[model samples]
Target: MSQRILHHPVLGSLEERHSVQFEFNGSVYTAYEGETIAGALLAAGVRTLRVHEETGSPRGIYCNIGHCYECRVHVDGVPTVRACMTLVQEGMRVTAGSVLPTPLKKGGHAN
Candidate 1:
């Protein structure tokens, strides 16, 4: 299989010195240190970042930088982390969902 990838904007002119291996959705991924998880996932063609709380809607990384809060994931047991802001470390564990407990809104008391 031939895979083509676009480099992240931050890696201007300098080659990635260290390549790290990690997993996403049980699948293996290789990315450079200092790169955001979302950017790495995008380079690997990971289009869906999350599912809606109740609708099961699919999501993907957008706005390579962390501004949209679209590529949120559970990183190393931490939830609600922005994939675009979190750098990928070797052997890091990540899950596809919000780590933060869902707030109860039955009476509009919590969010």
Candidate 2:
């Protein structure tokens, strides 16, 4: 899938915007000033932000809004933050699924 900037027929040309640098899973990436974390990642061709706790299924942004938690990621040591709702800032550190705690077993011990 091509993630390049699109020239909308109605919107004509997209205005030139300032670019900021951020780290995704330890790799640096460039994103626009007002773009959300999910937007930036998608633009960079990143489809999965995390994995399912139980089945380890790759999960990406399912809802642009804050409703779904599929885009949950760790930002600056914080966990379970929704990527679709969080805006990307310069020098921000985003970890894909690493900060999520290990799943607990039936006896409450981490698996």
Candidate 3:
């Protein structure tokens, strides 16, 4: 049930490419070479890349062009890498962003 676009009206058919394996949240998934992380994940039916830091709501790709930070995910232990901008690589480790503890105020309440 891949959502890959095999043919585009203007771009025509997709070129043949090798497949690569990457880990996402401890699960291994296959992705086509030269494809973006976001693209591959979406093709695999993975919509929620991460959750909102504060609200704990689901978050996924918003702007495929990388303008919006909604598609941000951890790649190879690095934090805040935009999934739409980063290309998928073999053996790469990707993890969904998680909520971090909020900064506390003078007493003990979160800011």
Candidate 4:
């Protein structure tokens, strides 16, 4: 028998696993129903989510609670989305753009 190596951490005892599909750099990735895109990305060893808007520096989740803006990415064709706070949905498409010195608001409510 053969097995595959695991990269992601085990989510604690979730009851149901809903299948959700999303794209990363034009590649497809799937996660459980309730998992965040950032969580799933980390599980799959995705370190860099977006590039710095100005400096073009690589960034990821500095704070899991959405305090830091390091893990910003574009979701569903929208730009400047905070990955730590954004929940994963079925067939969601995201784009990673360069970071900016000043953060911009999309929905007008700061996360």
Candidate 5:
């Protein structure tokens, strides 16, 4: 995954925050303090957060204000947590939302 740090031309380098370890899709990732899960995922170059249960289509962060439900994910066995609204914490375990009964294979859609 590519580095997701942004270099603002006007604001210059952003202040560094303490790094924390988190897990996404069973993989450990580093996230900075005060950064939302969505932001950390984006920084890690992750786009798709979950698959729509009905349509089986991939969904990602949208709206980003806790209004839209597009960025839902399973965090620590809790289903339907909003990625954009949740803050990353040390040892956090994040997983993509799954379809009930069986989860659709990655990149696969319902027939």
Candidate 6:
């Protein structure tokens, strides 16, 4: 089942929109034009957007708006993109963010 809101209390019903194809982590998925990347992924039942940069813990959408960057992902070879703020485009490529290496001190110890 899709997670999309088909009917809104105030907006009534959903309007027909063009469908677009996008790739997420090597898997192809369909999204509606003008829809945010995070929205499409959520509708497709994708909860985990990325892993924590430091701890390698699963991170998903915390804020639908652009304030919280928990939904950050790689889009079109670009890194650290806010999926909630980015619109889904045809042929777009989205990848989950990976764990980043910790910074090292001059003494070769992790900072």
> TM-score winner among the candidates?
6
lDDT of 1: 0.78
Instruction: Tell me how far the alpha carbon of residue 102 in candidate 2 is from the true structure, in angstroms, after superposition.
Output: 6.7
Query: Over the full model, what C-alpha lDDT does candidate 6 score relative to the true structure?
Result: 0.94
Tens-place lDDT digits, model 2, residues 84-109: 99989999999977434555755686
In lDDT terms, how accurate is model 2?
A: 0.87
Q: lDDT scores for all predictions?
A: 0.78, 0.87, 0.92, 0.77, 0.88, 0.94
Q: What TM-score would each prediction reach against the true structure?
A: 0.74, 0.84, 0.87, 0.74, 0.83, 0.89
The numbered model that scores best in lDDT is 6
- Over the stretch 1-99, how does candidate 6's per-residue lDDT look in tens digits? 678998999999999999999999999989999999999999999999999998899999997999989999999999999999999999999999999
TM-score rank, highest first?
A: 6, 3, 2, 5, 1, 4
**lDDT, candidate 3, 1-111, per-residue tens:** 788889999999988989999999999999998899999999999999999986789999998998989998999989999999999999999999998766764468644
Model 3 TM: 0.87
Q: How far does residue 11 in candidate 2 sit from its true spot (Å)?
A: 1.7
Taking every candidate in turn, the Cα RMSD to the unseen true structure, in Å, is 4.3, 3.5, 2.8, 7.8, 6.0, 2.6
Greater lDDT among 1 and 6 belongs to: 6
Off by over 4 Å in 4: 1-12, 99-111
TM-score of 6: 0.89
List runs of model 6 lying over 4 Å from the truth. 105-111
lDDT of 4 by residue, 1-111 (tens): 112133336654445567788898898887767777888787777889988776787888889888887888989888878888888998899878764666655557665
TM-score of 1: 0.74
Model 2, C-alpha of 1: deviation from truth (Å)? 10
